[model samples]
Target: MSERTKTRRTRGVLGGRSERVVLEVLGATVAELAESGYRAFRMDAVSATAAVNKTTIYRRWPGKALLVGAAVEWMRTFVHDVPLPDTGSLERDLIDAFRRRLGIKERVEGRAWARLLAEKNDPEVDSIIGAAVEERSGAWYAMVTRAVARGELPDGTDPRLLLGMLGAIVDAWNAKSPGRLKADLLEAAVRTVVAGARSGSLVRSPRRRPAPRAG
Candidate 1:
Protein backbone atom coordinates (compact mmCIF):
# COMPACT_ATOMS: atom_id res chain seq x y z
CA MET A 1 0.00 0.00 0.00
CA SER A 2 1.09 3.60 -0.66
CA GLU A 3 2.35 5.67 2.33
CA ARG A 4 -0.86 7.79 2.36
CA THR A 5 -3.01 4.65 2.16
CA LYS A 6 -1.01 3.09 5.03
CA THR A 7 -1.48 6.19 7.14
CA ARG A 8 -5.24 6.22 6.42
CA ARG A 9 -5.52 2.55 7.45
CA THR A 10 -3.54 3.22 10.61
CA ARG A 11 -5.83 6.12 11.49
CA GLY A 12 -8.90 3.99 10.91
CA VAL A 13 -7.60 1.28 13.24
CA LEU A 14 -6.67 3.78 15.93
CA GLY A 15 -10.08 5.50 15.65
CA GLY A 16 -11.89 2.20 16.16
CA ARG A 17 -9.74 1.43 19.20
CA SER A 18 -10.35 4.87 20.65
CA GLU A 19 -14.09 4.50 20.28
CA ARG A 20 -14.01 1.12 22.01
CA VAL A 21 -11.95 2.53 24.86
CA VAL A 22 -14.38 5.41 25.36
CA LEU A 23 -17.31 3.05 25.46
CA GLU A 24 -15.58 0.81 27.96
CA VAL A 25 -14.72 3.73 30.19
CA LEU A 26 -18.26 5.03 30.08
CA GLY A 27 -19.67 1.64 30.88
CA ALA A 28 -17.29 1.32 33.77
CA THR A 29 -18.27 4.75 34.99
CA VAL A 30 -21.92 3.75 35.07
CA ALA A 31 -21.07 0.61 36.96
CA GLU A 32 -19.02 2.60 39.43
CA LEU A 33 -21.80 5.09 39.92
CA ALA A 34 -24.28 2.32 40.46
CA GLU A 35 -22.04 0.46 42.85
CA SER A 36 -20.60 3.32 44.91
CA GLY A 37 -22.47 6.51 44.06
CA TYR A 38 -20.70 9.75 43.11
CA ARG A 39 -19.11 10.44 46.48
CA ALA A 40 -17.17 7.21 46.38
CA PHE A 41 -16.58 6.98 42.63
CA ARG A 42 -12.89 7.24 41.75
CA MET A 43 -10.87 7.37 38.57
CA ASP A 44 -8.57 4.62 39.69
CA ALA A 45 -11.53 2.41 40.45
CA VAL A 46 -13.00 3.08 37.04
CA SER A 47 -9.69 2.46 35.35
CA ALA A 48 -9.33 -0.85 37.12
CA THR A 49 -12.90 -1.85 36.36
CA ALA A 50 -12.68 -0.86 32.71
CA ALA A 51 -9.16 -2.23 32.22
CA VAL A 52 -8.26 1.09 30.57
CA ASN A 53 -5.45 3.35 31.69
CA LYS A 54 -6.39 6.27 33.98
CA THR A 55 -4.68 8.58 31.53
CA THR A 56 -7.09 7.51 28.81
CA ILE A 57 -10.08 8.45 30.94
CA TYR A 58 -8.52 11.76 31.93
CA ARG A 59 -7.57 12.51 28.34
CA ARG A 60 -11.15 12.08 27.27
CA TRP A 61 -13.14 13.30 30.31
CA PRO A 62 -10.60 15.54 32.12
CA GLY A 63 -12.29 15.10 35.49
CA LYS A 64 -14.73 13.08 37.53
CA ALA A 65 -17.62 15.47 36.93
CA LEU A 66 -17.35 15.32 33.15
CA LEU A 67 -16.98 11.56 33.19
CA VAL A 68 -19.96 11.14 35.48
CA GLY A 69 -21.99 13.59 33.44
CA ALA A 70 -21.25 11.78 30.20
CA ALA A 71 -22.06 8.44 31.83
CA VAL A 72 -25.37 9.82 33.14
CA GLU A 73 -26.31 11.32 29.77
CA TRP A 74 -25.57 8.04 28.06
CA MET A 75 -27.59 6.09 30.59
CA ARG A 76 -30.51 8.45 30.26
CA THR A 77 -30.44 8.35 26.48
CA PHE A 78 -29.74 4.70 25.83
CA VAL A 79 -30.18 2.55 28.92
CA HIS A 80 -33.14 4.04 30.74
CA ASP A 81 -35.22 6.32 28.60
CA VAL A 82 -38.35 6.46 30.71
CA PRO A 83 -41.24 8.08 28.90
CA LEU A 84 -44.48 9.33 30.39
CA PRO A 85 -47.28 7.08 29.27
CA ASP A 86 -50.40 8.63 27.75
CA THR A 87 -53.38 6.48 28.65
CA GLY A 88 -56.17 8.97 27.95
CA SER A 89 -56.70 9.89 31.60
CA LEU A 90 -54.44 12.58 33.01
CA GLU A 91 -54.59 11.08 36.47
CA ARG A 92 -53.65 7.66 35.21
CA ASP A 93 -50.86 9.02 33.07
CA LEU A 94 -49.35 11.03 35.94
CA ILE A 95 -49.70 8.14 38.33
CA ASP A 96 -47.85 5.94 35.88
CA ALA A 97 -45.08 8.49 35.47
CA PHE A 98 -44.69 9.01 39.20
CA ARG A 99 -44.73 5.31 39.79
CA ARG A 100 -41.84 4.80 37.43
CA ARG A 101 -39.96 7.63 39.07
CA LEU A 102 -40.56 6.15 42.49
CA GLY A 103 -39.57 2.71 41.30
CA ILE A 104 -36.06 3.96 40.55
CA LYS A 105 -35.19 3.59 44.21
CA GLU A 106 -35.56 -0.15 43.93
CA ARG A 107 -32.57 -0.63 41.65
CA VAL A 108 -28.84 0.00 41.95
CA GLU A 109 -28.98 2.71 39.33
CA GLY A 110 -31.82 4.32 41.21
CA ARG A 111 -29.81 4.39 44.43
CA ALA A 112 -26.99 6.04 42.58
CA TRP A 113 -29.35 8.66 41.24
CA ALA A 114 -30.72 9.28 44.70
CA ARG A 115 -27.21 9.65 46.08
CA LEU A 116 -26.30 12.07 43.34
CA LEU A 117 -29.40 14.13 44.04
CA ALA A 118 -28.66 14.23 47.73
CA GLU A 119 -25.03 15.24 47.28
CA LYS A 120 -24.95 17.54 44.26
CA ASN A 121 -22.35 20.13 45.22
CA ASP A 122 -20.27 19.68 42.10
CA PRO A 123 -21.22 22.25 39.49
CA GLU A 124 -20.95 19.80 36.63
CA VAL A 125 -23.09 17.19 38.36
CA ASP A 126 -25.59 19.87 39.25
CA SER A 127 -25.73 20.89 35.61
CA ILE A 128 -26.30 17.29 34.58
CA ILE A 129 -29.13 16.98 37.09
CA GLY A 130 -30.62 20.25 35.87
CA ALA A 131 -30.55 19.08 32.29
CA ALA A 132 -32.13 15.77 33.23
CA VAL A 133 -34.83 17.56 35.19
CA GLU A 134 -35.54 19.86 32.24
CA GLU A 135 -35.85 16.92 29.90
CA ARG A 136 -38.23 15.13 32.24
CA SER A 137 -40.19 18.30 32.84
CA GLY A 138 -40.61 18.74 29.10
CA ALA A 139 -42.02 15.25 28.81
CA TRP A 140 -44.41 15.88 31.68
CA TYR A 141 -45.38 19.24 30.19
CA ALA A 142 -46.23 17.59 26.89
CA MET A 143 -48.40 15.10 28.72
CA VAL A 144 -50.17 17.87 30.63
CA THR A 145 -50.68 19.89 27.45
CA ARG A 146 -52.37 16.92 25.90
CA ALA A 147 -54.57 16.61 28.96
CA VAL A 148 -55.48 20.29 28.75
CA ALA A 149 -56.40 19.91 25.07
CA ARG A 150 -58.58 16.95 25.99
CA GLY A 151 -60.35 18.94 28.71
CA GLU A 152 -58.95 16.80 31.51
CA LEU A 153 -56.89 19.63 32.96
CA PRO A 154 -57.51 23.36 33.37
CA ASP A 155 -56.20 25.60 30.58
CA GLY A 156 -53.52 27.43 32.57
CA THR A 157 -52.01 24.56 34.49
CA ASP A 158 -48.33 25.01 35.35
CA PRO A 159 -46.63 21.83 34.26
CA ARG A 160 -43.28 22.66 35.86
CA LEU A 161 -44.79 23.37 39.25
CA LEU A 162 -46.92 20.27 39.10
CA LEU A 163 -43.94 18.13 38.20
CA GLY A 164 -41.90 19.70 40.97
CA MET A 165 -44.57 18.86 43.49
CA LEU A 166 -44.72 15.28 42.33
CA GLY A 167 -40.94 15.02 42.43
CA ALA A 168 -40.81 16.50 45.91
CA ILE A 169 -43.35 14.01 47.13
CA VAL A 170 -41.37 11.10 45.72
CA ASP A 171 -38.07 12.44 47.00
CA ALA A 172 -39.47 12.92 50.47
CA TRP A 173 -40.77 9.41 50.50
CA ASN A 174 -37.47 8.00 49.30
CA ALA A 175 -35.52 9.93 51.90
CA LYS A 176 -37.83 8.90 54.72
CA SER A 177 -38.09 5.30 53.67
CA PRO A 178 -35.51 3.76 51.38
CA GLY A 179 -37.24 0.59 50.30
CA ARG A 180 -40.11 -0.05 47.93
CA LEU A 181 -42.60 2.79 47.95
CA LYS A 182 -46.24 2.20 48.72
CA ALA A 183 -48.15 2.26 45.45
CA ASP A 184 -51.43 3.25 47.08
CA LEU A 185 -49.84 6.29 48.73
CA LEU A 186 -48.29 7.41 45.45
CA GLU A 187 -51.60 6.90 43.64
CA ALA A 188 -53.39 8.91 46.28
CA ALA A 189 -50.90 11.77 46.04
CA VAL A 190 -51.15 11.86 42.27
CA ARG A 191 -54.94 11.74 42.42
CA THR A 192 -55.05 14.62 44.86
CA VAL A 193 -52.77 16.75 42.65
CA VAL A 194 -54.72 15.92 39.55
CA ALA A 195 -57.98 16.78 41.28
CA GLY A 196 -56.55 20.09 42.42
CA ALA A 197 -55.36 20.83 38.91
CA ARG A 198 -58.74 19.93 37.45
CA SER A 199 -60.55 22.17 39.95
CA GLY A 200 -58.18 25.13 39.32
CA SER A 201 -57.10 25.02 42.93
CA LEU A 202 -53.53 24.41 41.90
CA VAL A 203 -53.48 27.42 39.61
CA ARG A 204 -52.58 30.84 40.95
CA SER A 205 -55.62 33.11 41.07
CA PRO A 206 -55.34 36.80 40.26
CA ARG A 207 -55.09 39.22 43.14
CA ARG A 208 -58.28 41.01 44.16
CA ARG A 209 -58.51 44.77 44.91
CA PRO A 210 -59.99 46.10 48.17
CA ALA A 211 -63.35 47.84 47.92
CA PRO A 212 -63.06 51.68 47.62
CA ARG A 213 -65.85 52.06 50.21
CA ALA A 214 -63.43 50.70 52.88
CA GLY A 215 -61.26 53.89 52.58
Candidate 2:
Protein backbone atom coordinates (compact mmCIF):
# COMPACT_ATOMS: atom_id res chain seq x y z
CA MET A 1 0.00 0.00 0.00
CA SER A 2 1.10 3.59 -0.69
CA GLU A 3 2.07 5.88 2.22
CA ARG A 4 -1.17 7.84 1.86
CA THR A 5 -3.29 4.66 1.97
CA LYS A 6 -1.35 3.34 4.94
CA THR A 7 -1.85 6.63 6.80
CA ARG A 8 -5.59 6.55 6.05
CA ARG A 9 -5.93 2.99 7.35
CA THR A 10 -4.02 3.87 10.51
CA ARG A 11 -6.37 6.79 11.08
CA GLY A 12 -9.36 4.54 10.64
CA VAL A 13 -8.05 2.11 13.28
CA LEU A 14 -7.30 4.92 15.71
CA GLY A 15 -10.78 6.43 15.12
CA GLY A 16 -12.45 3.17 16.08
CA ARG A 17 -10.34 2.95 19.23
CA SER A 18 -11.22 6.52 20.08
CA GLU A 19 -14.90 5.68 19.91
CA ARG A 20 -14.39 2.91 22.44
CA VAL A 21 -12.44 5.25 24.69
CA VAL A 22 -15.27 7.77 24.61
CA LEU A 23 -17.79 5.09 25.57
CA GLU A 24 -15.60 3.86 28.41
CA VAL A 25 -15.21 7.39 29.71
CA LEU A 26 -18.94 7.89 29.65
CA GLY A 27 -19.55 4.68 31.55
CA ALA A 28 -16.95 5.64 34.14
CA THR A 29 -18.50 9.07 34.54
CA VAL A 30 -21.92 7.56 35.18
CA ALA A 31 -20.55 5.21 37.79
CA GLU A 32 -18.78 8.10 39.46
CA LEU A 33 -21.97 10.12 39.43
CA ALA A 34 -23.81 7.34 41.18
CA GLU A 35 -21.08 7.12 43.81
CA SER A 36 -21.01 10.88 44.34
CA GLY A 37 -24.12 12.85 43.47
CA TYR A 38 -24.04 15.57 40.84
CA ARG A 39 -22.99 18.17 43.39
CA ALA A 40 -19.69 16.39 43.93
CA PHE A 41 -19.07 15.10 40.39
CA ARG A 42 -15.65 16.15 39.13
CA MET A 43 -13.92 15.93 35.78
CA ASP A 44 -10.70 14.69 37.37
CA ALA A 45 -12.55 11.79 39.02
CA VAL A 46 -14.00 10.78 35.69
CA SER A 47 -10.63 11.04 34.02
CA ALA A 48 -9.01 8.91 36.70
CA THR A 49 -11.72 6.25 36.58
CA ALA A 50 -11.74 6.08 32.79
CA ALA A 51 -7.95 6.43 32.55
CA VAL A 52 -8.37 9.13 29.90
CA ASN A 53 -7.50 12.80 29.80
CA LYS A 54 -9.96 15.43 31.06
CA THR A 55 -9.73 17.12 27.68
CA THR A 56 -11.12 14.05 25.96
CA ILE A 57 -14.24 14.05 28.17
CA TYR A 58 -14.72 17.78 27.77
CA ARG A 59 -14.39 17.48 24.01
CA ARG A 60 -17.15 14.85 23.89
CA TRP A 61 -19.52 16.35 26.52
CA PRO A 62 -19.25 19.92 27.72
CA GLY A 63 -21.14 19.35 30.98
CA LYS A 64 -22.06 16.70 33.47
CA ALA A 65 -25.65 16.27 32.31
CA LEU A 66 -24.52 16.02 28.71
CA LEU A 67 -21.92 13.41 29.56
CA VAL A 68 -24.41 11.43 31.63
CA GLY A 69 -27.00 11.78 28.89
CA ALA A 70 -24.64 10.30 26.33
CA ALA A 71 -23.93 7.42 28.67
CA VAL A 72 -27.66 6.75 29.09
CA GLU A 73 -28.13 6.91 25.34
CA TRP A 74 -25.32 4.41 24.87
CA MET A 75 -26.83 1.92 27.30
CA ARG A 76 -30.27 2.33 25.71
CA THR A 77 -28.85 1.58 22.29
CA PHE A 78 -27.27 -1.62 23.61
CA VAL A 79 -30.66 -2.99 24.61
CA HIS A 80 -32.60 -1.60 21.68
CA ASP A 81 -32.52 -4.62 19.42
CA VAL A 82 -32.39 -7.98 21.07
CA PRO A 83 -32.34 -10.90 18.63
CA LEU A 84 -35.94 -12.04 18.50
CA PRO A 85 -36.27 -15.79 18.68
CA ASP A 86 -39.53 -17.14 17.40
CA THR A 87 -40.01 -20.14 19.65
CA GLY A 88 -43.66 -20.45 18.58
CA SER A 89 -44.66 -19.09 21.97
CA LEU A 90 -45.14 -15.59 23.40
CA GLU A 91 -43.84 -16.75 26.76
CA ARG A 92 -40.51 -17.83 25.39
CA ASP A 93 -40.01 -14.65 23.42
CA LEU A 94 -40.87 -12.50 26.41
CA ILE A 95 -38.49 -14.39 28.67
CA ASP A 96 -35.64 -14.10 26.24
CA ALA A 97 -36.30 -10.42 25.61
CA PHE A 98 -36.67 -9.66 29.30
CA ARG A 99 -33.40 -11.43 30.14
CA ARG A 100 -31.51 -9.65 27.41
CA ARG A 101 -32.84 -6.23 28.40
CA LEU A 102 -32.38 -6.75 32.10
CA GLY A 103 -28.90 -8.14 31.60
CA ILE A 104 -27.78 -4.85 30.10
CA LYS A 105 -29.74 -2.75 32.56
CA GLU A 106 -28.26 -4.51 35.60
CA ARG A 107 -24.81 -3.56 34.49
CA VAL A 108 -23.03 -0.31 35.42
CA GLU A 109 -25.31 2.04 33.50
CA GLY A 110 -28.48 0.82 35.13
CA ARG A 111 -27.20 1.60 38.60
CA ALA A 112 -26.32 5.11 37.53
CA TRP A 113 -29.63 5.46 35.72
CA ALA A 114 -31.59 4.60 38.82
CA ARG A 115 -29.73 7.26 40.76
CA LEU A 116 -30.36 9.85 38.06
CA LEU A 117 -34.07 9.07 37.82
CA ALA A 118 -34.49 9.54 41.54
CA GLU A 119 -33.09 13.07 41.27
CA LYS A 120 -34.63 14.08 37.95
CA ASN A 121 -35.94 17.65 38.18
CA ASP A 122 -34.24 19.61 35.44
CA PRO A 123 -36.00 19.64 32.05
CA GLU A 124 -32.83 18.68 30.17
CA VAL A 125 -32.27 15.70 32.46
CA ASP A 126 -35.86 14.64 32.04
CA SER A 127 -35.65 14.78 28.27
CA ILE A 128 -32.49 12.67 28.13
CA ILE A 129 -33.87 10.13 30.59
CA GLY A 130 -37.18 9.90 28.75
CA ALA A 131 -35.46 9.30 25.43
CA ALA A 132 -33.35 6.52 26.88
CA VAL A 133 -36.43 4.86 28.37
CA GLU A 134 -38.27 5.06 25.08
CA GLU A 135 -35.33 3.77 23.05
CA ARG A 136 -34.64 0.85 25.37
CA SER A 137 -38.32 -0.09 25.46
CA GLY A 138 -38.92 0.30 21.75
CA ALA A 139 -38.07 -3.19 20.57
CA TRP A 140 -40.02 -5.02 23.24
CA TYR A 141 -42.93 -2.74 22.56
CA ALA A 142 -42.73 -3.67 18.88
CA MET A 143 -42.68 -7.35 19.73
CA VAL A 144 -45.80 -6.95 21.83
CA THR A 145 -47.50 -5.01 19.08
CA ARG A 146 -46.72 -7.74 16.62
CA ALA A 147 -48.24 -10.32 18.94
CA VAL A 148 -51.37 -8.24 19.18
CA ALA A 149 -51.50 -7.88 15.41
CA ARG A 150 -51.23 -11.63 15.02
CA GLY A 151 -54.15 -12.17 17.43
CA GLU A 152 -51.84 -13.76 19.99
CA LEU A 153 -52.65 -10.94 22.41
CA PRO A 154 -55.95 -9.14 22.86
CA ASP A 155 -57.07 -6.59 20.29
CA GLY A 156 -56.93 -3.87 22.96
CA THR A 157 -53.40 -4.64 24.06
CA ASP A 158 -51.47 -1.42 24.61
CA PRO A 159 -47.74 -1.76 24.13
CA ARG A 160 -47.13 1.62 25.74
CA LEU A 161 -48.84 0.77 28.99
CA LEU A 162 -47.27 -2.66 29.17
CA LEU A 163 -43.80 -1.25 28.67
CA GLY A 164 -44.42 1.48 31.22
CA MET A 165 -45.26 -1.12 33.80
CA LEU A 166 -42.24 -3.16 32.86
CA GLY A 167 -39.95 -0.17 33.27
CA ALA A 168 -41.59 0.75 36.53
CA ILE A 169 -40.85 -2.68 37.93
CA VAL A 170 -37.20 -2.46 37.05
CA ASP A 171 -36.93 1.10 38.29
CA ALA A 172 -38.52 0.17 41.59
CA TRP A 173 -36.05 -2.61 42.13
CA ASN A 174 -33.16 -0.37 41.27
CA ALA A 175 -34.38 2.29 43.65
CA LYS A 176 -34.47 -0.24 46.46
CA SER A 177 -30.90 -1.28 45.74
CA PRO A 178 -28.68 1.21 43.98
CA GLY A 179 -25.76 -1.11 43.46
CA ARG A 180 -27.46 -4.06 41.80
CA LEU A 181 -30.60 -4.93 39.82
CA LYS A 182 -32.07 -8.26 40.83
CA ALA A 183 -32.54 -10.84 38.11
CA ASP A 184 -35.31 -12.62 40.01
CA LEU A 185 -37.35 -9.46 40.22
CA LEU A 186 -36.89 -8.90 36.51
CA GLU A 187 -38.02 -12.43 35.67
CA ALA A 188 -41.06 -12.23 37.92
CA ALA A 189 -42.13 -8.87 36.57
CA VAL A 190 -41.78 -10.01 32.96
CA ARG A 191 -43.81 -13.15 33.63
CA THR A 192 -46.58 -11.15 35.26
CA VAL A 193 -46.80 -8.69 32.41
CA VAL A 194 -46.70 -11.38 29.75
CA ALA A 195 -49.35 -13.48 31.49
CA GLY A 196 -51.59 -10.48 32.04
CA ALA A 197 -51.12 -9.52 28.42
CA ARG A 198 -51.98 -12.99 27.17
CA SER A 199 -55.07 -13.17 29.39
CA GLY A 200 -56.33 -9.71 28.36
CA SER A 201 -56.06 -8.40 31.91
CA LEU A 202 -53.44 -5.72 31.28
CA VAL A 203 -55.38 -3.39 29.01
CA ARG A 204 -54.73 0.28 29.43
CA SER A 205 -57.67 1.90 31.18
CA PRO A 206 -58.32 5.52 30.38
CA ARG A 207 -57.26 7.87 33.14
CA ARG A 208 -60.07 9.64 34.98
CA ARG A 209 -59.83 13.38 34.56
CA PRO A 210 -60.17 15.29 37.84
CA ALA A 211 -63.66 16.62 38.53
CA PRO A 212 -63.94 20.42 38.58
CA ARG A 213 -64.14 21.83 42.11
CA ALA A 214 -67.08 24.13 42.87
CA GLY A 215 -65.80 27.67 43.29
Best by lDDT: 1
Clash counts for all predictions: 0, 0
**What tens-digit string does per-residue lDDT give for candidate 2 at 1-215?**
99999989877855687867976797787788667755566778899988998887787788877887777676656544445556656666766765555565666665576666666675766776876556556756777877777777776678888877887887677668753666677778877887777766665557443232232
Model 2 residue 124 lDDT score: 66
Model 1 spans > 4 angstroms off: 1-23, 34-41, 119-121, 174-177, 208-215
lDDT (C-alpha, whole model) for all candidates: 0.76, 0.70
RMSD of 1: 6.4
- Model 1, residue 63: distance off in Å is 3.1
Per-candidate RMSD, Å: 6.4, 7.5
Candidate 2: deviation at residue 90, Å? 2.2
**TM-score of every candidate relative to the true structure:** 0.73, 0.65
Clashes of 2: 0
Q: Which residue runs does candidate 2 get wrong by more than 4 Å?
A: 1-24, 37-40, 51-56, 81-88, 163-195, 204-215
